[model samples]
Structures are given as C-alpha cells and as structure tokens.
Target: MGSDSHHQDGVGVPDELDRLWTPHRMAYISGANKPADGTPGECPFCRVPGLDDEEGLVVHRGEVSFVVLNLYPYSPGHLMVCPYRHVADYTELTEEELLEVARFTQRAMAVVRSVSGAHGFNIGMNQGAIAGAGIAAHLHQHVVPRWAGDQNFMPIIGRTKTLPQLMDETRRLLAKAWG
Candidate 1:
C-alpha cells in the first residue's frame, strides 16, 4: 500500500485495515432504542408479549415466561427466554417464573437443534450492563445456536458476523418447531 492510498474521501479515510460497515448496529451501541427508564412500560421484554407472535418475533409463549428471537442475533437461531414481568435480576423472579424460564430455555435449545441441526450452543445471561447485558433492565437468558464453523473469519478477523437468515424467517422456523 502506498501513502496516497490513505487519502480521505467524503465517506472516510482509506486505511490498510479492511472495513465492513454495519450502520444498523449503531442503534444498539448507542442505546437508541433502549428504554429511557428501567420500567415495565419502556422495556421491550415487557412490551413484546402484548404484540402478536409474528410482529414480536416470539417463538414460544409460556405461562410466565416466553421465548423470542434476538433482533440482533449472534447466530441465525439466537433466542431469549424472558419473563413477562419486567424484572431486572434473576433473583427477582418468582418460583413459577423461574421454573417457566428454565423450561423455555430447555425447549428453545431442543427446537433450535431440531430445526437447524446446531452442533452446539452458548447459553447464559448477562446480568447487568457492566456484564454486557444489552438490555440490562430486563432479565433474559440467551440461547445461541452454534455450528461447527459458525465462528469464521467474519467475526474473528473482520469483527463482523454473517447472519444468513432473517429475523422473521428464523422466528417462523423455531416457532413451528417449538409447537
């Protein structure tokens, strides 16, 4: 690479580093859609249950907890098991809520495996903002389906993830399989 190759265009400066721009992720990083206050009315988890399954991208609706597709998924079939109530911490869940969330998480894993033939899974919760919880206001457990080579050059080398499936499509497959 020559020095002239680093010229700044209207968009940005050309550099040696390869660029894969994902403007959509800015909303997540900037917390544009995050609730202003950590309240039920402003929380997406609390609001998702009221919407129809298709609109909400919900895979399974349990009595106390529900399974919904991750809008910005780590993988194609990434799902979150969440309680209907707007609780910030896992310890805040009632016995019924806790049991249902656990059940939903198990079912989510099975459904993802059956639908996508996932080789493995990465499942857990980021308890607070400091712990990397995108929506720290609501307690939810992530169930990310993983294949043999899912962690390829894109995420590792380029700091990007290539998601082959769309949200609605993944939701449909998982929801159908969950039934």
Candidate 2:
C-alpha cells in the first residue's frame, strides 16, 4: 500500500476489483489537505497571485476572484474560479468575493463556448475531501466543458486522456475569448 506498484501476482485480490491510478492528482491529494493552518504559502490559490499571469495560466483576474486553467483538467478549457482569499467554505466568502466568483464563472462559460465551442459544462465544487475534493482547504469552482464524445474508453481501459489542445494554447485562446 505504501508503494505505487505494490500488487500481488493476481492472487490476493479479486479479478472484479479494478484500480485507476491518477498520479497527477497526487500534488493536490497529498499536499493540499494538510494546510488547514490556512497559511498562504501552502495554499495554491493564495500562491498563484504572486506569479505572472502567463506562468500562472490565469484566464481573467477579477477584483476578488480570478479564473485559471485547471492544471489537471477533465476536458479542454477546464477552468477554476477561485477567490484571492484562502477561505475554505463557500459560506465564508465576503459579499465582494461572492459576487466576483459568480461573475467570473459566468464569463468562463462564455469564453469556453466562444473559444472551444463546448456543448455543455459541469460547474461545481467538491466541498470537502470526503466529497472528492482534491484541495478542500481552499475554495475553487470548477467549470469543465463537455462535448458529445468526451467519455472515451481511454480513461477507462488505458488510464490516460488525450487533450485536444495543449494547456498553454488553451489558456491563450481562453484569455483572448475572455477579452
């Protein structure tokens, strides 16, 4: 259990049990949960503002919230609307933060539609770790674009995803559309 490749010779476990390894989400699953002290250094939402826009992949910067391309995306043009503050719960957001987060989310949808021609979107957040949140300590709203044939066998059969555009290119296109 300690190591990633710790499996028996198909003896102990049943054949019905399947495992999908997502090593990319390790940075969030392992590190982000431990920063309940609410320190800025440990919170990625807090740290991103200090970096340049292109380096951070920030699509648009609002007064109290900002839209950034998801590092681990479900689809192309996947975005996260996050507050500048390191608040965890949705109820914790100030009126300004609340307003900006919602406004930014709306703009994100439009940008995705214009830039990528997305058929639909999945826009929500997993509140806590038990609720499947990778970074439960900081609040972030996911805006994932969905298409007709996105749910391919690659994710199920092969544990891999094929993105249509590079993250950097997607960011540039979204940023342009945001304007």
Candidate 3:
C-alpha cells in the first residue's frame, strides 16, 4: 500500500501502511484527510446529552464542556475533553469555557486511570489541522492512558498499534467511574 498504489476509494495509499491490509491502512490514512464538511457541523459532545443512552461513551457533560471516548484512539481507554462551543483555538475560549475544559480534562484523566489502570497519561490539545487535529474546527484535549510497558514494536516496526481492550468495555468502566 505504497503511495504509488491507488486505493479502491481512489485515494492515494499512504506509505506508512505499505505492508498492512487495506482496511487497516484505510483507517489510518483516512485520519490524515479533512472532513468533507470543512466544519464539525454539530458538536458531538453537546448532542450526547439528549441522546437515549445516559451511560454512553460520554462519561461526563457540562454546560460548556464534555468528555467522550475517541472513536479512533491511540489506546483503548483514550478520551477527549472538548468545549461545547466550536472554536478552532484555545485563545477563542472565554474564562468560564476554559475553566470547564480544564475541569473536564482532569475528570477525564481520573476516569481513564480508574478504568484502564494506567500509570500516567498524555493530555493535551492539537491546535490546528496541521498540528494533527483530526477536527480542526473544534479544539479538544486528548486524554490517552499509558502503562509502563505499553509502548511496543508494533507502531515502530509494523506500523500498527494494538489496543488491549474493546471500546465497549472501556466505555463501561469509564461510565462507572463517572457515576
């Protein structure tokens, strides 16, 4: 799946997944591209509250901030804390909004730790699309749970990263933590 090859969907194959299967490579490559809408369209975190599932992947939701599991995560228990209002940069957030974001971020880390038995976490924001933000229109803080020996040869050698647990299980654990 080198860049020279054309994917079935007609996009250029990413070089990183040259030896990987189509479906797996596709998922990784897709993250590199921007969404067609050019905007988040609707805030996913904000919409979760009105949805049927109260104990959804969304462990917490506040007036101006919320936390949800990352669908495509670096780790199984990965989550993100995002502001309800759409903003591309942290500078756009008001004092109250920033406060909420920080509060949710801390809460998300606590939940991730409790659920995943993680020793530490990588928690930060990618400011723009160029800075590796998958959703450029909305600034969000990622909370990636980490273990002592979690880093392995997969990502470095095989260009693939494996998660130890399922999203559903992670969601269940975090939901309990929220409660």
Candidate 4:
C-alpha cells in the first residue's frame, strides 16, 4: 500500500525532494534570514580603490558615475549605475550628475545586452527604502537584463533563483565594453 502510494505521484516528487535537501541552498536561506546589525556609516560602494577585484562585480567607474554588479542579482547581468555623489534622492543630484547618470545608464544597457545577449531590460530607480530601495541613502539606477525564458518555476515555486554566469565574468565583459 505504501509503495503503491509513493509510486502514484513519483514524477515531480523526486525533483522537489532533491531541491529541498540541497545543503548549499539551505545555507543560503539561513544566511539570508539572519538579522542584520543595521550599522550606519560611509557607503561601501562609494569607496572605489578597495572595490576593484573584490568579486565577480564592479565593471567600471567614471568621473560622475560607476557601474557595479548586483551582489544579489535578479538575473545574470544585473547591474546598478550609481553617481559618485552621496545623495539620498534624484532631486538632490546636480543636473550635470543626472545627465551623466542617464548617459552611463544607456551605455550600461547597451553593454549588458551586447555581452549577455539579453533581449530586453528593466531600468529604473526606487525612491526610498519603503519604495523597495535596497540602499535608500544612495540614489542609484538598476539595469536588469532580461531574456525570453528568464522567468522560471524555481523562483516561483522553490523561492530560489539560478544565475547562469559569475559576476566577475559579467564585469569583464562590461569593462571591455566601457573601454
């Protein structure tokens, strides 16, 4: 009776069980759920010299703006375009800085699409933390590369997203484009 019951719905059960038991995934979940200390100070991303070669991230930097790979990315080529100035909102930025940001964002989108073969992109800014801004103190624009079948059952069903490439590799590609 038990064997028959197990065999009755065996197709997706194995895959589901395997995903649920992944040790690395478990660790990631634990780490994500841990409470943050919420310390406030200088913006880590603003410190440029220390950032180079840190991870598979940080593609390039310019006079007014810089590009960084999203550490917790929604897609493979996810990136953020941030101004050098530490401003909380877009309104706080100088017109020159805003113009630079727009130019850099367009350049970044082209680079990401050309390098990653992304069919489309989602680019925008969240005004505040309450509006889903991860770093509310620093104004930045997100440039997320998208593909036809980018959305999958993993994120919807398993609450996990799979990235196809490393951030370092993406950075290399973007750096070449920036040059």
Candidate 5:
C-alpha cells in the first residue's frame, strides 16, 4: 500500500476528524441548563445553595459566600467560590459578600492543598460571556489546582482531561479538611 493509502476497519469508515466522545459536555454546549433570564430564580448558582452538600458538591459555606466543586472541572480539585446573591458583576458585591468570597477562596485553596497535595493553583473569575464565563449571569471565582506536570498531552492534543477522582469523593475530602 502507498503512504497515503487508506483501509477500512471493521468498526466503520476512517475519516480525517478525530472525535473524543464527551457527551457530558452537551448540556453545557447547548446551554440547556443555563439560566432562562439570568435571574436568581433560574441561576444554578443561586439554586445550589438550597441543595445539601453532596447533592450540591459544596465544599464550604460561609456567611455570604460558599464554595462548590466545578461540575466541568479543569482538574481533580477545581472549585468555585460564589456569593449567595444573584449578582453578576464583581462590583455588585456588598462589602460583606466581597470579604466572604475572598475568605472562602483562601480557605478553598488551603483545604484543597491539604487534601490533594496540589503544588499550585489558578484562581480568577471570568467577568462576562466575552471573558469566558459559562454562566455570565453569576459571579464565581475559580480555584483550579495545579501539579508540577499535570498539564499533559491529553488535554492539549486530544482535548480530554483525566480526573483521578470523582467529584463527590473530592468534595467529601475537601469538606472534611476544611472543617
């Protein structure tokens, strides 16, 4: 066969595209669960507070803000600190809410390090949809744990992330460590 020759396998016809099946991302991509009108009644962040810890994947809850595991995690211990209010902009936060969110972010970092032995972290918030906020209606600070060589070829080349642990288990560990 020549170098450019193609052969058909039993599975199906070969194509130029490389597909990685990640059905879980459809909801996010399709915006199926995004808030209908960017209000507290429709915002998932607002609704999350009402659910229990396991159900919500909540690591810690403070007076004004709370920490929850990211459903679409960048890493095993990725988390988000969000205020209970349905405000979208950072400047919308009250003094108490701002302080609590900052405090929760710090606690989340400490708890994740203690639980997962993370070497470092990426902490920030995406301001708007243009800024890459999946849910631009709500303000959330992302805390993504980083290891020495955690950035592997899978995510870069194959567009896949290998999470070593499940969200519930990670949440349990961090919650325990936080308290």
Candidate 6:
C-alpha cells in the first residue's frame, strides 16, 4: 500500500488501462501506407469492387454501395458500408449513393447480428482525419458488432487483437447471412 522504490523507477505507475502499442497504425494515419494523394484510381474503395466479391471480402454488393469487412477491425464482425465511388465526404454523396449507403448500412447491421450473434452495435462514420478515420479519403460507415464485455486486456495490453473468425471465413458467413 505504501510507495515502493520500484514506483520511483523511470517507468510511471500502472493504472487500470492497459497499453496497446499500435506502432503501425501511424503509417495509416500519416497516409504513408495508402495511395499518395488519395485519388479515385489509387483508392482502395475504388479498387475493391473490381475484384470478385469474395476476393474483396465484400458481404453485399448493392447497386451503388457495398458492405465489406474492415481490414483492421476494432472487433469481430466489424463491417463498413461504402459507395463504389471514391468520394471522401458524406455530404458529397449523390442521392443514389446516399440511398444505397443507408440501405447497405442497414443490411450490414442485420447480417452481422444474424451471423455473429452480436448483442448490440456501434454504428457511425469518422468523417475526417482528425475524427479518427483511417481512410479519411473514402466515405464509409462502420457497423461494429458488440457483445457483452467485448472489451478486454488482450487488445489493450497485448496489442494483438484476436478475431475469432478469419476475414474470409467471416465474409462467406456474412454473405450467406446477407442472402
């Protein structure tokens, strides 16, 4: 209960929150790992659709928008609803893209809930770089499945998040669930 010499060591006192050393995330934040200028031709959102649905990890392919798994997910069953066009801002979406994005967002919620048995959901968009959008150049809506006590020290302390299901496995399952 009293102060120890170890507490006086260079390292600070440990608190309840564990540390996750996500060093690589810095590359994404700085736009060093993605296309240089964030143009449509160089964008992943623009390129993913050209690949087959399975290859793209796409759950559903609507007319203007699609649902795909988040490659770096905050949790299992995390999906993103995005327009095929490489638009950055939500307000920039055309009426058709807007409608399809909404529809696919709904579809993403339903499919993830049915397939992953998620107890709840976290749904939204991080509009810009300052708002924690990794790919701020693309407009995408996140649909994250939540179970009770999903938060834990593994991701927090170990810095390694373990998703129970492989992305391809999840893609197939969600694709089936979508249908």
Best by lDDT: 5
Per model, how many backbone clashes are there? Answer: 0, 0, 0, 2, 0, 0
Residue by residue across 1-179, what tens digits does model 1's lDDT show? 56555563424463344455556667777887688878888898888899999999999898899999987777789899999888899999999999999889888889999999999999999999899988899999999988876666555666555677778989999999998
Question: In candidate 6, how many Å is residue 166 off?
Answer: 1.0
lDDT of 1 at 164: 73
Model 6's C-alpha root-mean-square deviation from the true structure amounts to: 4.3
Estimate, for each residue in 57-149, the C-alpha lDDT of model 4 and write its tens digit.
678777787888776677777888888777778999998888888998899888887887888899999997699776677787999988775
Spell out the clash pairs found in candidate 5: none
Q: Rank candidates by TM-score, best first.
A: 1, 5, 6, 2, 4, 3
User: What TM-score would every model get versus the actual structure?
Assistant: 0.85, 0.78, 0.73, 0.73, 0.84, 0.80
- Colliding residue pairs in candidate 6: none
- Residue 30 lDDT (model 1): 82
Query: Which ten residues in a row are the worst by lDDT in model 2?
Result: 2-11
User: How would you encode candidate 3's per-residue C-alpha lDDT over 40-59 as one tens digit per residue?
Assistant: 55545445556654445676
lDDT winner between 5 and 6, please give it: 5
Q: Which 10 consecutive residues of model 6 have the lowest summed lDDT?
A: 16-25
Using lDDT as the measure, name the better of candidate 1 and candidate 2: 1
Off by over 4 Å in 2: 1-38, 152-160
Q: Candidate 1 — which residues are off by over 4 angstroms?
A: 1-23, 152-160
Instruction: Candidate 3: give its CA RMSD in angstroms.
Output: 6.9
Scored against the true structure, residue 20 in model 5 reaches a CA lDDT of: 48
Candidate 6: what lDDT? 0.81
Decide which is better by TM-score, 1 or 2. 1
